[model samples]
Target chain A: MTTARAGALLDRLGRVGQFLWSGWAGLAGLALFAALWQAGHERYGDFILPAPLATLAAGLTIAADPAAWELAGQTTLRAVEGFALAAAAGAAGGLAAGYSAATMRLARPILTVLLGVPPIAWIVLAMIWFGSTDGTIITTVLVAATPVVFVGVAEGAVTRDRGLDDMARAFGAGPLARLTTLGLRHVAAFLFPALTVALGSAFKVAVMAELLANTGGIGGALAAARANLDVAEALAWVLIAVAGLIAVEYTLVHPIRSEFERWRNAARPWGVKR
Target chain B: MTRETTDAAPSLTLSGIGHAYLGRTVLDAVDLTLAAGEVAALVGPSGCGKSTLAHIAAGVVEPSRGRVARRYRRHGMVFQDPRLLPWATARANIAYPLRLLGLPRRERRERAEQAAQRVALDRADLDKFPIELSGGMRQRTAIARALAIDPDFVYFDEPFTALDVALKRRMQDLVIEAARGARFGALFITHDLMEAVRIAHRVVVMDAHGRGIAGTRAVPGKPGGRDDGTVYRLVAGFLSDDPLFRHIHDIDERRTP
Candidate 1:
């Protein structure tokens, strides 16, 4: 029993070690990329390109400023709100299209049109309606993200096991029960990937829309930095925004995705080791 | 033995049952009756409408032309594939049909455990996902799922085809034992005549064209005393001498020996 307890502890430690190794490898790759960027800046000079050290100093300066946090908060809020709205709408739409052939046919043309129109084009429309505000940023993010979620969920719905559905019917599972137990379970797998991609897209689109509309966010700070030709500060703000994106993706999106896919991951070769 | 209720009606009936797929005739004017507690096997050639007939009986596919009537309110099925939900645990898969019946969670779990025990599935394996299981284990889970609801009628479509000979025999025994209790009637489809004879009270042979039921033979006595030798002779006799059974077994003989 003591030996078995020791073995279990060793196994736990081994998993932690593997996780750390992978995390370090990823960090090393990012560091290497940054070093190359710094070398390129040294060759080109600071006006056109900023070194990693200069960018980091500028980032620290921005981090110290209360206004920078306020702008970051605005961008974060808009992106999240847009993403939440897009997820709800897309899931509802996807469920409808998945369950009903008529709804799918009717909605296909409209979704296609919406998906085909570029995020930038939507920003123009948003600007016309909401005009240089958070609403414009949110609308742009919504247009860019909803289709990813919709298509993900629709594909999931289409691929649902007819056998299970038949089993459910044989057992007299009501429509609502079927949807909750079988339908949602299948769709959950696709929904996470869709949400992850949409969330990332939401951040990028929200920031870009803010930059274009001159709204009060990190995008406006980027615009100001560009206007002043403060290349290091601009690069720093870009890095800060990217870091925020990674943070949100890791902390929010990944945890939810992992929770939904824990069973799936447990079946995978690598996932079994952990 | 409990006598079948005379007023209960037949568990299932197929009269003048005919089916075709994309202009190819599979079953023709097949007439079959399954009283409550009867276990019948539909056996024939690969292209014979055994599976198609099973599908028709299960209401997964509509018959091209025929009349099928069932007294049972609930029916369960096991396919050639395990067909358990990849996302769900073995217990959950077994409980799935019960969940549809709106059984409370406690009742569902209890029934699932009982069904798994009936199939000789280990209690430890209950929480394991389908992907975590071996092929035989998965098939056992499927059997457990089908039996979990204590279905009045069950349809099995070549369910043990993937199993090894030993595992196949074990599963056959489970089905035979389950049927003997009179809790369920089953329409079992298979190309293996020996398998049919081992478990079925009556075996129906379908025509190659799948147009209809061509022939049927009753295997006398309970399946418990029937050895493999008895099953082989029965299949061999049907293959060579029985005129009604001849066509279905001809192709299998050419392929096997």
Candidate 2:
């Protein structure tokens, strides 16, 4: 019993050590980039390039303002809402297209047309319909993100292990049970990566749409800062938005992704020892 | 006194079973019967539709113009490959059929444990997935799964062909022991005559053309735990000089020669 307890403690220590190592690496990379930015500022005047400290001070000022939180929250809400809709629609559509050749053939042309068009092209059309509202921003994100998710899910469905499906059928698994258990389990791996990409794209597209439409958000605040020739403030808002994106990715997406990836990580072939 | 049904009537029957793939006939007018409580081993050369026959019997394939009647309540099958779900552990794989039948979780796990014990699978291996298992263990897991449902009719399609000699013998003994309980009947398909004589009550040799049964031989002793020497001479002599057995055995020789 004592030995078992000791072993458990040792394992915990090892995990802690690994976590610290990764954290140190990330901090080191950030420090190196900041140093380079500071050096560039010293070489060039503040008019051309702001110092790293100046950027950080400007970012702190914006972060203290209540309006910045409201704008950040708006952009985040639109991005997440649009992403959820795209994920659901893409998965459903992809399943239908993947399972039936006829449906795939019918949907192929439509998917091609949507995927081919640039997100900028949809901006004007979205503005006309929604008149520069959050609806336009959400629509822009959906247009940019849905096809990426569709292709991932469709490939996942097409490449599903038929043997498992046959076994499930032989053992009398009903259609819904099979879909929930086997179909979704197989698609989860592909869907998660696609989701990460789509989530990232949603944030980018929503911000772009807000900026283009001159709506009230961080994007609009950025435009106002630029109009006032407050380059430091503009860059600071951009930094704050990026930091928010990183925070969301780490807290929301990364944890969920790692939960799903544990299985994959366990299956990976740890390199052969010499 | 109550009169029982005739034992002569086949428990399972296949009449004029023929299968063709793209105008090429693989099995032609094959008539076969499996008596209740009988263990029959079907042996023939490669591509003689041995596996195909097993598949047809297991209802995985539908013959072009044939009917298979089963007097048994349920049929369980083990293929040449173990065919266990790679993601599921050994215990879970064994309990798959029971899960399909909607048994409660406790009951399923209990039955799976019982089945694993019967097949001599160690307790430590129960939670290990297919990739973590040895080849013989995988096959043993497959056998346990087939037996977990207590199937009245079991079809084994070259199940031991991939195992090492010791593991193969152990598996063969397990099959024989299961068959001897009188709870199940089996249709064992293999190309090995010695294995056929060792385990089966009656051995039916299929002709090369897959037309009909070429020959039938009754094994002298009980189905399971028979001494190897008792049937060794008969099997060896038939395989060496008997013209009917000779035709199928010669095919293996010709390739190597």
Which CAPRI tier for candidate 1?
A: acceptable
Candidate 2, residues B191-247: lDDT per residue as tens digits?
A: 988889888878888978677778777767676657878678868887777777878
For all candidates, the clash counts are: 7, 0
DockQ, each predicted model = 0.47, 0.29
Residue B213 of model 2, lDDT score: 74
DockQ score for candidate 1: 0.47
TM-scores of chain B, in order: 0.89, 0.92
Among these predictions, the greatest DockQ belongs to: 1
In candidate 2, which residue pairs clash?
none
lDDT of 1 by residue, B27-137 (tens): 789887887777888887886667878888888777888898988867888989888888788998999888777889989999999999989999889878898899999
Q: Pick the candidate with the highest lDDT.
A: 1
Which ranges of candidate 2 are over 4 A from the true structure? A1-54, A174-176, A261-263, A267-274, B1-11, B22-24, B207-215, B230-232, B249-257
Q: Give the CA lDDT, 0 to 100, for residue B105 in model 1.
A: 92
TM-score of 2: 0.84
